[model samples]
Target chain A: MSDTAQAARAVIGDSEFDRDTAVTLREPGVYGIDLSAGWTIINAVNGGYLLSVLGRALADALPHSDPFTISAHYLTASQPGPAVVRTDVVRTGRTLSTGQASLFQYDDEGREVERIRVLASYGDLDSLPDDVRTSVKPPSFPPMEQCFGPEDGPAPVSGSSAIAERLMLKLDPATLGWALGSPSGKGEMRAWFGLADGRDADPLSLLLAVDALPPTAFEIGLSGWVPTVELTVHVRSRPAPGPLRVSITTRNLAGGFLEEDAEVWDSADRLVAQSRQLARVRVG
Target chain B: MSDTAQAARAVIGDSEFDRDTAVTLREPGVYGIDLSAGWTIINAVNGGYLLSVLGRALADALPHSDPFTISAHYLTASQPGPAVVRTDVVRTGRTLSTGQASLFQYDDEGREVERIRVLASYGDLDSLPDDVRTSVKPPSFPPMEQCFGPEDGPAPVSGSSAIAERLMLKLDPATLGWALGSPSGKGEMRAWFGLADGRDADPLSLLLAVDALPPTAFEIGLSGWVPTVELTVHVRSRPAPGPLRVSITTRNLAGGFLEEDAEVWDSADRLVAQSRQLARVRVG
Candidate 1:
């Protein structure tokens, strides 16, 4: 096995099955799985598990696929808990390969959990239609060299939560000296994300990694406390190789709820992915 | 008027702009903005524009006081459009007198074109805790009687586009309904909904209405198309009111380049609204 693959397996397996797993195949590049524990607690399977399994199967079905960069967007857990995943390739087209997978979690009695349908495609990146336009821009802030890491200073009040600490440790204010790429080659970035534990993870891990950041980011900006009810992300493209930097902005928040949308850009200003999340606020 | 009140008027008009002006005062209630245009062409002014304005203002404020409801849900301009609405108390919470309003459209020059918001609260209804649940049941098929306005031998598709005709005319074999009040005396609901026009509209619109289908009567089944990019709903109780039903599902074409989410729902088993949408699909 390659060193990269070995390292990935180590981190994922070491972490209580919390990270997404990717497997490379000759036909469609690489496949991945987003696993979870089901609500039954006894069965050890759930909704997210099924979706992750499905994701992996889809990835394996494509031809002319890029093994270097493959991923699945948001796969949700309809019913909470640990779940198992399985994948299968649907078809391989000239330009694109299609794949599907199923997520299964058990009920209290060890019955099958709800199933989720997984769909994925692989191939040369396609250009957006002439009419579709992105209004998001890369965020400008202090560079990594000048910024303080979470451990470098006292953690922010919001950083008290484990999720918050994980986020702060993964993100940098600026994107200097990072590899970048995007379909448009103009407005997104990706970098080698430095985790507190000193391990590098994939885009799916990065997503789980950053999910808790917006609330912290926003809370610090507002100088208050904000709790997120749920967070959802849409991956447009993967970040280029290197330390990752994410550019985000607040779209809108109403009815005690806040929505923040982000355009994840590679260091080269390419649109790697787009994410949006909803959060509930707790006033001081 | 207070400084905040006066400043608000400068940007929006006075509270008494029009009976259907779209913006109304309601302590604790969210502000409403309606964006609807006459048939031929529905511009952003009626929807996106209004949301942009209301979203911005709401962001500046914190924790409102009045209780509000989303009475209507549909599609416009092939996109998801939701009106932030507010309700004002007529009897000051004594006898349950209240008024509601919303701003629909904003012209190219940023003026409202079509808008609607309603005000209501259980008048003389018993004061209760957050103990309602949805008892409403979904139908096994479309409620043709309530949806077609009586002269129904199967509703005719009415729209300028052929695509719309196929969608509006094709009836799905599914049931739709909604239950109001609480099942376990908790304010919740179970609802079913689908397209009034029968054709698909936009994913975002379908999601918005599905998310806004009030609380279910029991453990309301939350299902829809589009894989739910993100979903967030809040309820004070369970068993909301009537058995509101919504039906939504979709199909993708062109190697999944584009897809749609279709939906329909009944108010008291009566057709209330319908929606459809387009989306970008990725295969994994």
Candidate 2:
């Protein structure tokens, strides 16, 4: 193998997230990956986790190391299995490199199926200007010790949520009432996020962190899986080594769809990422 | 000419906005248009106005008439002149039709220059469920008679803004402090929006309304034109026939970039659209 390919293959960390999202360089723009069943939300895999896999491949193909902006359209549900990622380098500028990635899987009949399409711009976060001016405050959360999660309590809802086990999500008690059949009806959720395997969050992993919580629709007493139609995440900066504070809010729910917006602040209370997605929801 | 082609060519309205954004069907997936000089902010046309032209073309290319979601990456500044919009129908489902459009203009040497690339999904807004649930409130503004604008006062800053004449913008007195060389430093702007020609705002025109204000960064005392890198708009519903309420805010300013989020509500107090964009800002 070429030295570049060797470097790409050897960069996989020992963490479960790193291993699951690792990509094997099959060619210059083609990559091979296996979607981990451990990250399944129920029967299907998490859209953000799938985005991570595609992001890993794009990172390898591009000149930059960090994903500054990623816009993904979820065409359909992605299954946990072997898949292929095709990357196209759209533009490589001095400070930013724009690219596109399409993740595909094979069916039982050997027919290839495209799962998600992503357009992203990558740049080195360290090379950015050190000026940070935030006019908006981060969402308030309870002490980390006071928060609860799947590891400390029963699952939020009854289903096969393997992701709840892999992700360290501590939900704010105020937003956790939906588990007891009494929702807050506020269309908001706050959580503290980390990895079960003790891996630190970075720009790439922040992709998964942005979508790691249950749908905010649950706070309004809505039931069933909220399938994301399109998700756009803006990774503002690298994070500090600690649990991340996550706040999600839904402003409008209509037209058989709902929009969810999320903001993530790092341990140092810096805004690390912002995301918005439109999901399928039923008024029931 | 065929009936469909004739209908497409004859749909142009007498309003200036309709005349500026009107498209001629050149082929199955091709459209011809002229970017309006009347919408120029300083040297280049407004990013949102450019998007409106693309939305008009996409509306004709798809089965559905209303654009529910539009994600556009402004590759470079588009000039006021002739341009071509190339549309690609990605997928046509029962409820939505997803497509992509690339706006191009020829250079002086006759080379095609790609300006913006957009991905949008079209749907029938009237067919959406009537069950509207909004957890967020619209931004407060003074009475229409109390609001001020370019027609009522001096221009916001010393520059050529033809858009100020074409767009009936009523800036709240609180947010208008930026115009007096003294900024609010809050990174927020609220305005009442309408068209000078009495053109009613619809789903397609809402694309322009979401971006029709001075950059929120201006309220923070930042100077220079903020060039949008990427803009995404989610049109939630068709607007009522009246002036639109627009609120723009910027939460983070770092990495020589700033993020702007916008919300537009109709006179009926319904959330008509929401948008988020990342733009290049010099922190001078």
Candidate 3:
């Protein structure tokens, strides 16, 4: 095997392949391979991998102590395909640092492909008014244990077709978990999220995993599934090093495009990163 | 009149006022006016205007020459809406100089309205390749003399529709003319535009005027129109100071969204700027 492949295998020992990490790989950066033809690819590179590789790079570049949050994430892909990725360091000041990146990918020939850009920053946390509060609170949902555990709910639909299916995923309507996250994770993520798959896991893992969910949700309301042209993510806050709950509230779908704006909250209800995506929907 | 209004009128001048220009002034930024209600508000600023402001700012900040071309432009906007603009300075060395800009917008209140970042520098132009060519060639349409005047086009379906009806109004095919501006005014632009009230003009005037053409060209087709959430433009090469020609082209439109990519080429067929936009399609 190639050195890269060997190293990847070494990192992914037998014990490391848990159900949660089964879909994800650690090398070439932490990536999720959609084994099936859905070809949904997710990666955890530069520390946190949501969508924006640039954002992830910036987050990776920041000092652990600096407070940085991903305020927003977006991406669009067209033409030659794949997608090209580029990053820019807007300003790397002592207290506040800003950076941006764009991904461009072409088809076999060097023709234009998809283009994605991400903006991110690291700095001191802003002080909120004493009386300030979020207008929308995270949803109260049952833990993945009670909702989708192997013994609790139906097995997740598997195979390539599973990528195109909607898991009827929804936040538990009864108990809204408190949002909580690490000091650095600050943007709009503190909320609640329920996967179509019934796995309960770490907030960081959930954060990385949920990034793949938007495109799937976008396909739910469409006549047929729409593939993602590109996915860009920005990490605003790091979840408290544990379980994180977030609610997917607003979904704006127009034209042949779909954008899902989710409020990701920590277990303590603190907002983390705000996530959104430009999904291309395909109708039969 | 508001200070903004007074300033706009003074800068624009009165020449049988173009309603579209007036709309732009009233709604100065990217966002358009809400014609449904009597309130005329500039919802969002255009990406091009933002780039101009930021580009000028960056150029003035850096020790550079008077004129320069943009190397790249990146932008992102959301539904319900907010947007951010970013630009980058490719190189500021002695020879040819380049820069880029991107804009980002959001829909949430507490979230950012829009972010605009620019990259630019000054340099000598001698080092650049003498035979650079553009893939998109300018269209050889007739001049304004042979085409219908702006007044000959269609009028606003409703005087109160915030929707830009002028873009939808078709002109006599012969009305095709070069957009007047820089000596190489090469790019894509079409107009008989304005309340459909036939008026004929050159390219620069069109640039200042067509800013009102929302990004609906991809969906309804050029013959039809739709509202644009955001507009992005990259000025690669400025035409010689005069009228230029723009060949309109639609790249792709899917789901309920559309993207129109236009190449503005000079009379000599040299490319000047690349323009593209994402528009939200209104559905029944």
Candidate 4:
């Protein structure tokens, strides 16, 4: 319906995930990209997808390659367009390098908008100690046929959103309060996530998968635009193939403030990424 | 030993927790306080105390008073001094007000040292729906007398650290890897934490309690000072009076990086606060 949305779809269809998330070098610490709006929820883009874009830039500058950890502070809501990413290497050690990446965009008046500042660590996951292996058990799911997704038919409630077209989110209808028209009255959402284009979710793609689900706050009877204030994602293991099963829970919803904890498990049933965020419960 | 440390102890000793955690409002969005070093872990003060200090400042500027969620990024190590806290209102909505606070101190060069930035939410905990109650089971503990703390006698191996002199941390002993001279190899630590001065632990105090345990990495036989890269804390309920039970687990220790998740339960056995961190395995 909009020119930007049309452009986003074109860019996404024309490029692969590596290219869709690509950042071109602009000197040493500066990088730039024309962000596609294909992953937006209404007007705001998904937080994890934004972080993946920034993480890609930060990871490239580090000696080691894998993004071990990423903490993103959403300074302001941003839209699709040309954005600049600047990286500042804070601490470099033998095993990890900590860096801060700030994404900026210019307003119509040409004033710069500081959208996000991501604090991240890049290291070699392959080098981790395989001897000391332990994990929080991955959550179980019902039969795949019982789940709802683009494959099931078409997006019903979120059909108009760009992300619905870009991501294949098979939500467990038991927790889909919006679809059932009866809130679960609990703060939880479970879904199986993968790219609509069938691209394997690497650590970077796993970042986007964390935020791909509809806000779990809906299950608690809080209907609104749940904007993230700060999000911290921890990459646990190299994800296995197939759809990553995810569980997002909001344990405390007090005074319109809630925290969402999302655990992403790969098809092999191993935990891949763990994310927790602090957000205000916006009741629209 | 230092004047700032002495000042911190006096302030902490003289007031009740409510007053101790209260920040003096100098102006709108500006807060000032004489920070205490009584909660230091070796040379670097405990991350939770710093977070509590910053949380106090941000909560003061907000319309709602309780800090339901806090995610802090420690940019650099700080010391006891007159810390200046500045809060920036990021998002103000019907039920939540998300604000960012930066705590700054002047270094010996008279230059400003931005030690930490805290993203926090202030809201009414009483407004939470009581009917939808659930929690992960709290860990069990042996008799209080069987645990280890300063009052129990000597510190054993950790006694050399100044933090041992400052707080009372009673470990379960079953996972006290360093003290037992045998690593559990399970990557876990369980303990009971309370203020040393006999003060009841409040929400702010609960922040400190989360990081007060011995590094769980030590249980897996990883030695050294593990510095937290980023920490996200979720306060579920106003803690009940008495010592809080805690369980710390390190699921994956890889490539010189590890994650520690800490869950806290109040005396009444309610989940009070939960925290997880990404840290560099700094083996000194």
- lDDT by residue (A213-245, candidate 1, tens digit) is 334323223324444322333344444544456
Relative to the unseen true structure, what is the C-alpha lDDT of residue A145 in candidate 3, on a scale of 0 to 100? 52
Which pairs clash inside model 2?
none
Q: Cα miss at B158, model 2 (Å)?
A: 7.6
Docking tier of model 1: it is incorrect
User: Is 3 or 4 the stronger prediction by DockQ?
Assistant: 4
Candidate 3 chain A worst ten-residue window by lDDT:
A178-187
Error of 4 at B115 (Å): 5.9
Evaluate residue A210 in candidate 2 and report its C-alpha lDDT on the 0 to 100 scale.
84
What DockQ would you assign to candidate 1?
0.03
By lDDT, the best candidate is 2
lDDT per residue as tens, model 1, B210-232: 43322221112322222211121
Candidate closest to the true structure, highest DockQ:
2
Docking quality band of candidate 2, CAPRI definitions: medium
Q: What C-alpha lDDT values do all the predictions have?
A: 0.33, 0.84, 0.35, 0.75
Taking all chains together, the TM-score of candidate 3 against the true structure is 0.39
Q: Estimate the Cα RMSD of every predicted model relative to the unseen true structure.
A: 20.5, 5.4, 18.7, 5.4
lDDT of 4 by residue, A137-167 (tens): 7777876678887546543657768877767
Model 3: per-residue Cα lDDT at residue B83 = 31
lDDT tens per residue, model 2, B1-284: 11222232222265677888999999998999988888888777988889999999999999999988888877767999999999988778888888888899998899998888887878899998788888777877899899888767565542357887677788888887788888899889899998766677988789999888988888888888788878889999999988899999899998888888999999999999999998888545
**Model 2 per-residue lDDT tens digits across residues A1-284:** 11222232222265678888999999899999988898887687988899899889999999998888888888767888899999988778788787888899998899888888787878899998898888778877999889888767555542358776667788898998898788999889899998766677888889998888888989888987788878889999999988899999998997778898999999999999999998889545
